[model samples]
Target: MKLRALLLGILLTSPVATYGAGGNSVVTVNPPIPAPDWTLPAIQNAKGNLSMSDFRGKITYVDFWASWCGPCRLSLPALNALNSQFADDPVQFLAISIDVVEEDAWDFLKRYSVDYPVVIDTEGDIARTFAVDGMPSGYLLDGQGRVREIHIGFKRGDELKLAESIKRLLSDLVTSEVDET
Candidate 1:
């Protein structure tokens, strides 16, 4: 974990505000690419492992966060509420903590409880695969696991914007299903 944390610090040297949406910026991937497959252990090992493929055929919102990241403190709770609003929908939300130390993540979660699945990327493999460049980054993936939108940083009202995007995607899914039938 220590080594992974060191490497991440070196790799994530870019300015946070340059790309993506939220309070900072949100960039739509020009040509959506398939999200890589990954299986990560649940935070504190309290639950079974989770994989990217598990949410297949659903609108997956994967959030990369850490207890130490300031923006993440805000993003998690907001996302939790958004997840509840779409509780009956085909949307699935997953939060992955990139904290080097496992305890830090637990401490943060104690105060800001979330309902969605939470996992810990102890080896940092998941974050590297997603090319996470900033703290509290989010990837909105389509049913087929394509990365449709990227969100970086979090600010007040950002959750509203995210909710709108999710609704648009859900509508798209409904349209496609109707066409198929």
Candidate 2:
């Protein structure tokens, strides 16, 4: 399609690099980029909408995925575990699904268990805003909402890096709080 071709052209021209074993993510944005702020409605018209500013004091992980994306299948489960691991910490995990069909997303959720918040971006605005180059792209933001790392794809052991990033952010927050006190 024309859109896919355009996206490919953009990726080819950008600083994007692909490196992953076993055909796993293949895309990585080095030197982590700063994430843009945005708000989106909940997946099912559920309670409160998701706003980037709401999690300013917490380590935030934002995942951009689609229901039909193969990598998302693997990414979701790993993300679920990471979300659970930080349940009591000052960490927030959010998923932005680019699925055109709401039902498809709902169906996929039934197959996978996710404990964090999920928002549906039918127009793909959030993904475009983040310049997602792959299906399972993720942005790890520090407490101040600056992107600390950009993960372009998913693979086993990926959660370790994410966990470590969260730990670092939490540690930094504690240090700052103590200094203030």
Candidate 3:
């Protein structure tokens, strides 16, 4: 009876052996991708309806902002700089406005003279999807569309760090592809 009880206790407490830790263990999170098959209404500059799926092959930065937000205004130059820096690359910088009206957003964009693609989220649908709780939130998506980084507030040196991270991810992707081939 003692032996049986001891064996039962061990069986109950022991960790089960797992293949790669579990059947559904995450090896890695690629980067933020657009939500799966997410088709949004046509944004201002898009030729057709836009979805996160459209940018599947490139690294993407999605900025959730409102024109009235001071921090959002301040971050424009940095975002523009990033856009300029990666002008020739496959990375895309998208600014999504959470403004209630298109004119308010367009006015701000014109005032800023921002050069990157701007997507209007008039209904705040996209912002809600990303669980955005603050203005001027930035999300960096890897080339594979996984969320690689998320920033809620602006900081002085964030742009530089963001650029470096994207470059590093791009390099890693290239290196890995070469290795795989």
Best candidate according to lDDT? 1
User: Against the hidden true structure, what lDDT does model 1 obtain?
Assistant: 0.81
Q: Kindly list the per-residue Cα lDDT of model 3 for residues 21-46, writing each as its tens digit.
A: 11211111232333433565545556
Off by over 4 Å in 3: 1-37, 41-45
What are the runs in model 2 whose C-alpha is more than 4 Å off? 1-18, 23-34, 44-46
Name the regions of candidate 1 deviating beyond 4 angstroms: 1-23, 44-46
By descending lDDT, how would the candidates be arranged?
1, 2, 3
lDDT tens readout by residue for model 1, 1-181:
4433433443355233243344466666545677888888887324888888999999999999988888887899999999999999999999999888889888999988898889999788878777787888899999999877778788978889889889989999999999999
**Residue 154, candidate 3: alpha-carbon lDDT:** 69
Query: Each model's TM-score, in the order given?
Result: 0.86, 0.82, 0.76
Indicate the residue-level lDDT of 148 in model 2: 62
Clashes of each: 5, 0, 6
Task: Quantify all predictions' global Cα lDDT against the true fold.
Answer: 0.81, 0.77, 0.67
Best by TM-score, which number? 1
